[model samples]
Target: MAKVKINQPFTLLDTRVGVAERQTVQLEVAKLYTHTPMTIPIEVVNGAESGPVLMVCAAIHGDELNGVEVVRQLLSKVDAATLRGTLIAVPIVNIFGFIHKSRYLPDRRDLNRCFPGSEQGSLGARMAHMFFDLVVKKSNHSIDLHTGAIHRSNLPQIRGDLSCEMTKEMAMAFGTPVAIDARLRNGSLRSEASGLDIPVITYEAGEALRFDALAIAAGLQGVENVMRHLKMLRGRRRKQVHDAVIAAATSWVRADVDGIVRAQVTLGERVSKGQILAYIDSPLGQSEEAIIAPRSGIVIGQQMLPLVNEGDAVFHIAYFAHANSIVEQQLETFIDDIGPIS
Candidate 1:
């Protein structure tokens, strides 16, 4: 494939960032009820040479903060003079939710589901419209950073519609131990980007509201890997520590009884079908129920909080074609390679 030359200055949010220059732009999206202005902070790094424009954004859910740190660390290491293309980094997309330390907007609507939004729609829609039009559409490719919901933790993984060749390539380039061939959710940024023919892959890691060192380190490395894959960063291709295994399907194991959960499995642990993952016991210790895995797979996600209600999801397992034991070894090696990230 021939590389497209992009020597011209990159324009975003009405600001022109010249080659070899880095600029931080404050994008006004909405106003707070107290009359204070709310803006999404964005940094554009226009490279010295020509390559694909890649957008790495995080905190679309506000509380999913691992990605914010990933973007921060990634920007710290990127030098525009040595870069081959543009890097548009948006650290926080939902200012309102971030301020409140919640996952939804002030209107209680999910910002992620409001993509390709209308200018005259609700607050989420309007903010989504501003972000989608001004930021997302300006890129040739995208990496959406995310984490599990509140009180849940996800193993480092890449999720995308792997049917698309470009999306699959980006997922593999991300180098997660496991990559889920996920379906695009309607109204999501990925879905809307696909409409415009933009290849976007989402990186899911850690838990919401808190930062995990390993997750953050892996995320930072994954973004750099993708950038190198796109030739936006100059480097001889670094091989993935472990070749990412594509999951055939994933399902959540729900608790059959409401109680405090005593989890027996950890993230990345391979479990056999019908194996006990967690035991839900009553407060008085009079009753207990074991939560069993419905299928043999790797535990990709699980609820962090011990308490759960009936039918609450406790574990997320991903099925693969490879032997579960081999996947477990790959996961162990990947974690050891990352080590402690203090």
Candidate 2:
């Protein structure tokens, strides 16, 4: 771990943050049509000692709010005096979409798909450029938090480019029941950060526009676990009740008919090939169809909304080299460990 100079100030966004200090920097992203300035609040906690710089950010999609709460809870618990390195927490990246409770920017562009952007580009591009240049570039490591899209829920899982050893280690240290070897999408923050040799991981859980206690709790624990693993926090790493199992690939099961779906299996449930996962019934009750699993895998995400159109993605299953029973047991153990969420 690299150490910061003793008593030296950590500089970010052109501001000097002294050691053992907590500061909130307002990063101006844009101005509203009403002429009001829009800024993203970045909370920086510079610890007393030198260590790695870890950035934990959320709400890139704006409505994916479980991560916002995770960042909030994390910020509440992190003490600068005791922290080993600098912790940069950006709870909301897309202020425009967050205010509207929508996933896309006002221009209808997905902010997440625009990364390492250009100042001369579109609205999403400009904001992405500023954020990446000012916030993300300063970090040694990063954790991007997310949740399923609207009316969808995801089983807590870690997604990263597992081919990278550093990313794989962080993903495993996150202690989720499932870790996916996801491919890097173009213009994604993970891809941009990885290009700079900064290992980043994405934590997916809960549902967009809703807060899930289990997901929030698990995310908090996962962030802390990674901190310990990175030696940013001084404590023996907590042994996971069930170590995360890597998924070789994931597939989404789409609704076969346009109707109201009656799901037979829930998130984290293990299913066999051709198993009946859901039944779709027409609104008039005249027609019905069974949605079966294309292959045997563990359910990592599913549609929470009952109504679905034909070809709408319903269940997301991840295939693993290990026994499905093992992953099922890991999910069970994780749920038990977290207990009931109120």
Candidate 3:
């Protein structure tokens, strides 16, 4: 560990007890179109003891406000003086999207997809580069928070590569009812981080631009569980939460015809093969088309929009050969553990 100089008060490091100061590092990443400046807020709690440095970031999409609030609530309750390891919490990364309540920047580029960004690249690429350089490159582990894009809704779930031992351990520590052993997408932050030998698990829940209480509660609890797993804090004996079942694959059930859609199965509900999951109806209420489940599985995600286009994704079902009774029990337990946000 590099010894921080005593006169360098800007960087707080206590050598005696090894507890460093929690400082907010503000960096002006970019300028907004409205002639206002945009800054990235990075709160760093570099603990006195030598331990893992975990980074928790949210709102890369700018519209995903649930994780922003999750990080906010987590910071409010956590005291830096008692922490063992370091915690870097960047509550909001996309200031542009956050201010406008949109998923992408004004340039229409998805920030999450721009990874290992180039300094002299597009706007999104530059932002990604600065983020990765300052935060992701500095952390030992990380968790990127996300939500369903716009009208889409997701049952609170943790997505990661189960093949990686550390990634799997972190996902299990997340304690979500469902864990999608999701594959990495090209140009994605996780994919780039993996290339750098840093495994990051993304927690997707609720919907963009809207704050779901259940989702927020689940996210908050998941972060605490991860911190506990890392032994960053001391105190009460925590229960060993079970690992999430790795789904072989997942697919979305699409609407047969464009119309108003009515869903029959709720999120986290188990369904049998050929189960009527929803119904698509014409605007005039003249004709109706039933949306049935193609295979028996749990409804992990769905769209919130009542209106849909033909072949629009309606439900996300993860198929598993396990009995519904066991699946339902795990779902119930996961929900119960979330408690209440307020």
Best candidate according to lDDT: 2
lDDT of each: 0.92, 0.92, 0.82
TM-score of each: 0.97, 0.97, 0.92
Q: What ranges in model 2 sit over 4 Å off?
A: 1-7, 238-241, 340-342
Candidate 3 lDDT tens digits, 241-329: 66576666789999879999988998889998999998899988899999998888888889988999988999999877567657678
Q: Which stretches in model 3 have alpha-carbon errors above 4 Å?
A: 1-18, 236-240
**Per-residue CA lDDT of candidate 2, range 1-342, in tens?**
854555357999888899899899999999987989999999999998888899999999989999999999999999998898899999999999999999999999998889999999999999999999999999999999999999999999999999999899999889899999999999999999999999999999999999999999999989999999898888875655556999988999998779999999999999999999999998888988999999899999999999998899999999989999999999989888776677
Return the lDDT, model 3, position 298: 89
List the lowest-lDDT window of 10 residues for candidate 3.
7-16
Local error of candidate 3 at 319, Å? 1.3
User: Which residues of candidate 1, in runs, are more than 4 Å off?
Assistant: 1-6, 237-239
- lDDT (Cα, tens digit) per residue for candidate 1, span 16-95: 99989999999999887797999999999999998889999999999999999999999899999889989999999999
